[model samples]
Structures are given as structure tokens and as C-alpha cells.
Target: MALAKLKEAIGKEGFFLELDLADLKSVKQAAEEFLVTWEKLGEFTSYTCQWCHDSPLDQFTVQGYDLQFGTNTLGRYYFTMLLLPALQRTTGTNMTGKKARVINGSSIGHIDAPIEIPWNVLKAGSEDSKLKG
Candidate 1:
């Protein structure tokens, strides 16, 4: 719907991109497509996200990461790191006269009650853990 609205406003000048940041495969695909197009155009870009995904309010996982934390912070961090090379190349001031900007659109939720990481839970590990083997 957001994509549709943006397309309606921008018409042929707009392209739609869908990325499910919860999944690494999707992130890789987005990074590859972005690099190919941006490098071709010799244009620079910035990225932003308002971390909004959430789990049911009452539940907690043993591994200890909240759904919003995974979606907002971890996913944003991974995507930025993955695309840094392309972003840097395109936005380098020597070429485009612009430095790449990364806007992590955070909210009062994170600011007001930041998670006190349970390093123990983080280390305990779970099969569903998105981090890695």
C-alpha cells in the first residue's frame, strides 16, 4: 500500500522495492539490486527505517530478543553493513560531493525503555535464533 501510494504520486519515475528485513535472503537480494542500479546511475542515496515490527505485548522468548529489536535494530544494522561498500562508492564526496547518510528512524518506545540485554540469554542460543550457527 505504501508502495502503491508512492507510485501514484511519482508515476513512472518511481520503482517499487519490497524487502522483508526479517529474512537474510531478502536483504541480500535488496543489496544486490540496489548496488547494480545505483552504480549504473552514478547517483548516491540514503536509507531510513522506523523500526515497527513487534511481537504480542505479553510474550517473551528465552533467547531474549524482542521482535521489534530484531526488526528495527539488528535488521537495520545488517543491511547497512551489507550495503556500505556500494553506498560509500556512490556517495564519496570526491565523486558525488555527498556523504552517505543512514537514518535509523527510531522511536520513543526504544528510547523510553531500552532493553537491558541479558547477555546470558543472548549466549544461550536457540534454534530459531536469527543470529547464526
Candidate 2:
């Protein structure tokens, strides 16, 4: 299976955790589980790719935010904040002798978005407003 291959490729130390960023509850739960499972977190990386244009109109997060903004931005923020304590624990103890980092990957398409994003529209789940912005 693909997962088996991934594990093999990454070696015995690499691990994967299931997370659904679209759901705030899931993000909170995953962060809690990660803290319990891993005493020290060296790096927290999130690679959510929800193209703003490709997002569906009908889909919305439980908090009523636009799916793309909720999943790609808010969810990641919440999850990272939740795991901050664990990350802080690794401050000077990293085996690599480097500071811990949180990386969130964004696409080049983000450059095309309006410089001033309409936060109200996004929070209100207005897909049309998002497109216009």
C-alpha cells in the first residue's frame, strides 16, 4: 500500500497522523493526541492545498466560515497554537541543534488574491464575496 511504502521510504522514525483541518474539532483533537503521543515536537508542518477557486460553494465549516479559509488558514492556526507548548519544549533540545519551526505551505495562486482579504466575507461563508475579493 502507499502508506506502507511511505513508511518504508521515510524509515522507522517517520510517522503519520490523521487530521481533518476542515473541522475545528478534529484539529483540536489531533493536537491533543499529538501532544500525548509525542512528548517533544521538533517541527510542525502543515501542507494543506485548498485552491480558493476550486473550493465548493456548498461546503462550509461548522463555524460557518468558508471551507478553504477555514481549513487552510484558521484550522492550521488553531492546531499550531494548540501544539505550541509541545514545540516550545523542543526549544534548545533539538538533536539537529536548530530552532523548532512551524511551516505552512501556500501556493503561488495566493499572489493573485487581493492584498486585502475580506475577513468578514470569509467568516460569513460568502463564496461570491470571496471570489470578488
Whole-model Cα lDDT of every candidate shown, in order: 0.55, 0.79
Name model 1 segments beyond 4 Å from true: 1-12, 40-66, 92-96, 120-133
TM-score of each: 0.60, 0.81
Residue 36's lDDT in candidate 2 = 91
Pairs that collide, model 1: none
lDDT of 1 at 4: 80
Please write out the lDDT profile of model 1 over residues 18-59, one tens digit for every residue: 666655567678878877776533332434343444434322
Q: In candidate 1, where is summed lDDT lowest over 10 consecutive residues?
A: 55-64
lDDT per residue, candidate 2, 1-133, as tens digits? Answer: 7778877887655566778888898889898889999988888778877876555655668887878888889999999999999889998898777878898887887877779976766765454644531
TM-score of model number 1: 0.60
Candidate 1 local lDDT, residue 66: 47
